[model samples]
Target: MEIRWLEAFVVVAEELHFGRAAQRLHVAQSPLSQTIRRLEASIGADLFERNTRSVSLTPAGRALLPKAYRVIQDLALATDAARTASGAVHGTVRIGFSGAFNHLTLPVLARSIRRELPEIDLQLVSRVRTGDGVAKLRNGTLDLAFVGLPLVADDIDSRLIARTRLGAVVPIDHPLADAPSLVARQLADDDFLSMPVDGSSAMTEALLRCCIAAGFRPRITQEVTDPYIMLTLVAAGLGVTIAAEDLASIMPRGARWIPLDDAPLFMLHGIGWMADEQSSALRAVLRLSEAILPTPPD
Candidate 1:
């Protein structure tokens, strides 16, 4: 069957309304209906159960959904591969970066890529949480991603590019800010701003694990999805927070960053991608990452 037929079918399945699906596909309803009918005839089964008021996927359509998605996704990847083989390097490369990476490293990376690989277009997507970065990367949406160390997935391959220490970010005038260095036990009783319990923020979990290793489960006063917002709250004196050293570069006003005493220094940072296939843009970015960021001493 034609790819367009499957595309039209999937759109109808998702929208469940011919007019709505047609509009979403930027086509008229009559042609969309014709396409669906043609697809059904080819498959020898009706795909949608429709009436005057509603549209629903039939059994055949339900079964075809996953395969259709896979076929479309594979076809897109193939197209990108073709573009790469042609030496065009002209398609969009969606990159996922954390807030800290965006603030400190992206400018340099973007400038270098534009200068050297002017033919390859770049799209920057900032994920407030690292899990979002991983998810986007796995789903083929992101060509490459900047993530911290301790990415435990076996399906991902990464190279460590830089290292940053963990620190406590507090209000400038907060009592703990003046200490020589912050320790997990010293701030055990302090209300903290932490990441969601769902484990979306790797750095936050690293900090929490640090606290647990010191014999306490932090009394988190608030949980935020975005680490940047968590730091903002810390700056406002709402609560204390643990963040990477690079985070200080994007500190909101009134914040103080104190190095963690004997902290379990996080893996500084890494460029990651699916282990099975590496795209040209991803490899180029990885090489550039190696050049720009220092490799930690062995």
Candidate 2:
């Protein structure tokens, strides 16, 4: 079968709607339907169960998906390899980054890459959450990601790039705003807010344990991914939250940051890439990142 056929099939599988998949592929619905029908005929089985209101993948389609994904990823990697063999570092390395990485880590890394490896192209994606970054890296959509560390996964590799302590963000008018620093337990009674604490990183579990030690379990009032949004929610008198110290510069208009006194309760920021990544551009960035990101303090 043609690669386009495979591409069309994958898109349809992902979307589960012919019109939506066609829109994603930048084609009309009729031809996309025709292609899937032709693909099904060639493979001698129905890939999708379709009706007026819904579409679902058949067992055959489900079984073929991961293998097809691998075929596409391998083909792309081979193409990138061929480009690298042409004697110059060319091709884009898609790097997924989140809040603080976009505001802080990215600038330093970008300047270094531009100055030292101008031939390499960088596609920087911002606003990615930790879980989404992990998924993207695994699916070959992102070459690498700047993510929270303490990730133990069989499909990905991570290494520490920077370290930061978690701190409190409260509205400036709040009673505790003037406090210089705080022990983790002190915030237990406060209505807290934070990113999803789903074991995607060590911070979530650590935060819970810290609060429990502080004599009360935290009542999480909100779950947010954006630093500014967390601060914004605080500024609006919604709740108090915790965030990395590196993001202090962009604290929302009415919020104040108080350093946390817990020494070992810090976020370990790191680079996560697919275990089998072989991109020349990704390698160059990883090398530069080692020098750009500071060594963890003893």
Candidate 3:
């Protein structure tokens, strides 16, 4: 029932390994294991199933995870509120953003924060994938995040900031490079370079959905994490890729972006924060965003 026990439980659940969880918590494995045992006894349920080689969460562990995250986050916010009341600490806001914001949105937002909210400490974490961003927001590790839209988390609040058509990136001399636009099926047989298929990437998920809707799964030749690198590889003739059409402005010289004729296949970008967030710093940033960020096109 103690906070430390819940912290240990959450860390162990995330790592699924006592050794790694202990290392992360800077505690001995024996103590970490004892903590989890104490937590389970208090809750009257077994939280994990462990064997010699593997550790997996039990049903009780899965059920407790999200609630534990909220408890820890709420405590942290209460502490922050108390400190802010006394002016002991100016607010610190941690913001996570994907690579898509690097070229413009992030820089502009940073400058605006520096000029308008000089007392606030702005921590910018770059290259945060959409899924990871959402997770961080829920756990209170991030105050806000720029993420792919149509986000369905009940605990998160999001607003659309931009929308852009998804398109194909190809080598300049590739057969379809000169086409004005293309249907998703046109690239079915081509070697496709894509973002990693782990559920963390919104772009990768969009690409798969688009290909499947087009009647064939894309032949993925390589999985790249960075969009710039994905385009660079495409420019080298390694393979073609599906990406936001706006990226064409920053793409390498040897690559061309071809728009997708599939109207529904587009990327929606948004800023998201926990629905129950009570941080004044977060509210300030959201207010500034409304004035500084562009509205999505209809």
Candidate 4:
């Protein structure tokens, strides 16, 4: 069967209105109706039950609906893959990173990807907010990113490549600085610096939930969007901030990194990509992510 006929049938099956489907398909109503009739004849099945009032799919049409949709989706994916294979992958793949990434790990991953996927160029971008990865992915801008959970974007697919212990970063001279391990409750009366509460920022949500799970709302004294600035605040003794243990390696001096004992031990960090589009660069980076990720703590 001609792909156009299947396309026309799928459109009408989804819309259930000849006129509206025709408009959506940017074709005349009469031609669309004719296409559907021709398609039904070719398949030897009446795909739609249409009366003067409305239209509905027959059993055969309903069964064909899902399969037809898959055909189109798979075709699109194959076409894209062909394009990628033809050296069309020579475009910059924009990547976003959450502020919570280990300072060393992020750069190391980027360098490895550049070495492996030379045809695909990469640009490192920073995002202050989170969970907007799906929107960027859908629009064809962001190829992949490293972000913290819980990411609420169902449209984008993520793999939990690594889990790092959560820790408190505080000034070295702070009262709790000497403590080898930190508990969420120990910081109850301490001034805290956190990310915003808006759902757009995934790391913010993670931090808020961490505080709540500890039994008391944090005495949040300042809200900043920049991770570097938040770390600076901790260094300046303005407030303490929580971070992943892997980040401790690159942290500036004069700050103490204390592991959280009773609190959720680890934060999930994942490599995310557009679920619908496959990228050669992304596949390479994802492989590197899996290789570099430190094993989860016991």
The candidate, 3 or 4, that scores higher on lDDT is 3
lDDT of 3 by residue, 46-119 (tens): 99999999999999999998999889877877877887788644578899987853566788888998898887
Cα displacement (angstroms), candidate 4, residue 182, comes to 3.0
Identify the candidate with maximal lDDT: 3
What are the lDDT figures for the candidates, one per model?
0.78, 0.79, 0.85, 0.74
As a whole number from 0 to 100, the lDDT of residue 289 in candidate 3 is 86
- Sequence-dependent TM-score of model 2: 0.87
lDDT for model 3:
0.85
Clashes of each: 1, 1, 0, 0
| Pairs in clash, predicted candidate 3 | none
Better candidate number, 1 or 2, judged by lDDT? 2
**Model 2, range 16-63, lDDT digits (tens) per residue?**
999999999999999999999998999999999999999999999998
Residue pairs with colliding backbones in model 4 are none
Worst 10 residues of 3 by lDDT: 98-107
> What 10-residue stretch in candidate 4 is worst by lDDT?
127-136
Pick by TM-score: which candidate is best?
A: 2
Candidate 2: regions farther than 4 A off: 110-121, 201-203, 213-215
Q: For model 2, what is the alpha-carbon lDDT of residue 35?
A: 96
